[model samples]
Target: MARENKRKAAEKAEEGDEFTGREDKRPRKEKVQPSQIKNKEKRSAVYAKLKHEKQVEKRKKIKARDAAFKQAIELGEEPAQKMVPRTIENTREADETVIRPNDEEFLAGNDADEFSTVLKQQTVPKVLITTCRYNSSRGPAFIKELLSAIPNAHYYKRGTYELKKIVEYANNMEFTSVIVVHTNRREPDALLIIGLPDGPTAHFRLSNLVLRKDIKNHGNPTSHKPELVLNNFTTRLGNRIGRMIQSLFPQDPNFRGRRVVTFHNQRDFIFFRHHRYIFEVKEKKGDPKDKKSKALKEKTPKKVIARLQECGPRFTLKLVSLQHGTFDSKGGEFEWVHKADMDTSRRRFFI
Candidate 1:
């Protein structure tokens, strides 16, 4: 420690803090702690074990291959041709037959000793997500990142919802997860369903709230009135939303799509994660003339940013809480009402 003191002492003295002990003392060697040495040994042991298992696994695979080859030879099967040219004997009119293996036979082929049954295997769910913005862009980009973290994930353009040809896409693949992204304008509404992660279901409001809730994303349900942009959002989204959500399968909380919320497109809807609804963003579109309406509508863009930003943190808390509640599905869209079915009293708000 004398050398360490000497090294530091000069600098310390220059800096006006006195260094204790002899300036000429020899530097002590750093003590190698036993715990560090043990840790190195443990790491080496783990690596050695992993290497051994890999080698053993490689040997087992080779043995199985050799057994198959020998059995094939014993059964007088044709020898596999090496580097054969496909064009040599191939003809255009040859009928192709595809053979599907029997499930029982396939299961029988797996080594009984090995854990080869498909049941124990965990599958990452395939996800299809859409956002309010039609760009094969931000929403698609987020899905890519999500799929990177998962496996067997799929993504598509939100605009494809508009196409008549999209039925094939909808019918061909089964999505284990479907997500929609929407921006939060205020405390998000009652009807907003945030997906859960484990499977194809979700929670609304607080997962634990144990109450039925219906929401109007762009409209304030409490006020029983629509905000200016929220009303426009409702109308604009109403026509397209059913097509957008039709292909989506819902998932429970912990779903990946709802991971982030963006203010970038609040003027439109953001249906994030796996969901059945869309967000209706409310913004002050123009100068308000009336005192009460102007006071409510005239918040700065900065406040809007805060409201949207709070979406993620609050949603995460709600999801993590797993607030237990049951939702009874209400028929039809919130904005869609047929005059034939509506009571005259209820039609007052319809106009």
Candidate 2:
């Protein structure tokens, strides 16, 4: 019995060894990369082949989706929902500062904010636009376009006057906001937006400025107040900034003018675009069976397609700092300031 047990144990050990040996002898597959090829021609060929394979796979997926959709239609069933591609904006890190639609506290706070009076239409928004002490020719041109864009906006030349003095003057003149365009090396590089009377000032780094004349086939702006569109201003700070900007324009827009001023924020950068839109009637030919049907069709409004023409002076703004009360560099309280450490993560965003 002892000898039989030993023999069985030995057999089991041999089987284990055999399994290990089998695993060891198995050929492992390694991923073949196009970069591994030393020959440039071969590398190019491999890259092309890989691209072709990807295209073929994509086509196959599309075909399969089409086939499934057709089958669902035939069976009078719901088609599969298309998958939404993940993007940086969609996958951003969750922020507590992001404002919710039903936040009573935020809503209440906003009602009594500095720009609240203007936003509520209690008072008209009067904006005073100015440049740095040392100005450039292009600065005036940009200010001219801004004048056309914003209603009740007036430009004042900055003739060696201090910003504090200008802010005081704006407050006295009952201006709701003050825009100070700062230029560096003859190029407009920064913008200072100061909310009048009380406080809350925002400093933005400006870039990618394109004037009205630079735009091809740009439309002329009318005196009518253009509609204001503020997009993606979701955070608490963003909301304040949005309100400040909104205060620059009138509450009521003249839709007849078909003019629009859009401030679209993406990746914490605000893009300014002015456009004039016109609706063109789309004519459709159809034969009515009877006079009544013809009369009904005629009563129906014609399909009008909207077309947009850019009214330029397009630029981008990146928020640098937001101060609580006006422009005081040395002794001012900051609400939010952009720091180098704040940009450690690409998915993280302030506004």
Candidate 3:
């Protein structure tokens, strides 16, 4: 112990004059000075400036487009097309009713053809429309528009009532179908269509909606107010629901004819319309000898009409594809779907 103490004493005595190879066991971090904060602010300022410039450039582009369109109208040239890029799939393709199969396609079998023919002759339907209480403000407007389009549609406000109970109520009331709106973030985002008495339930995403107010057709006002046009996403969904309801119509109509039901959705609100489509002459304006005809006498506007015959029951139908991801699960009645399913070739219906 004495020899060890003497060696330590010798090492301590030589520490001031000689180097010992040893690193500090713990190092202290440098204190952050106020200057570092200023440097960070400087970097962020540069980013902010860049972001502002980009936004200005985008606004300028939009203004230019509007001006160009106005100029074209004055020159009597073709109006400029708005080339706004879409971040998501849109409904332009689904705008037409061509997605529904023709009589020749699915009506090949004698039994199926007979059933369709019966449906065409006698179609009466009763439908129930339910709106999410969270979206009451917009829901009623949509409901009113649909009521005008469809006949014998009942409206209800969905509060704390559960889906099972609602379905039961629909069944007891003798409703052919139930349409439910589901809201998210104060916006109507999804739709649920279920056939009464244990039929498949379809859920769809509703987007790219254009209501009647949004369209400025001052020269031509449609009777359909708060009109809704569903996008491609909803059209594919509607295709499925249409087929299900089509099956429900019996092969033979009663003395009153065939009865059909439909549940359509747009902008997250469910619409009901149950009428057969028919052709009629479109409306005209002014006289056939008007001076406006002198500009282009060679061009004649052919009128077109897409009307409904009010066959049995008047209602609307719109619903779509089964997907795994839109947050759907195997057991739930509403399944989440993917965007790709909108274009699937196997879809039973279109728009």
Q: Write the per-residue lDDT of candidate 2 for residues 91-191, one digit (tens) a residue.
A: 99999999989999989999888988998999999999999989987888889999999989999988988999999999998999999999998889999
List lDDT for all candidates, in order.
Answer: 0.34, 0.92, 0.52
Best by lDDT: 2
lDDT of 1 by residue, 1-351 (tens): 999989897787655533454454547789544445567777677777778999999999878777877888899996444444654113222222211344455345433311122113332234554443334323343344334323344556555464222323433464434444432332222222212222222322221111111222321112111111112112222312321222122222232232222111122222332122234555655556655555555563422322221111111212111111211234222323234444334212211
Q: Cα lDDT of model 1 overall?
A: 0.34
List, residue by residue over 317-342, the lDDT tens digit for candidate 3. Answer: 33444432121235544433436555
Candidate number with the higher lDDT (1 or 3):
3
| Candidate 2 regions with alpha-carbon error over 4 angstroms | 1-57, 73-78, 282-303
Q: Which one wins on TM-score?
A: 2
Q: TM-scores of the models, in the given order?
A: 0.21, 0.81, 0.40
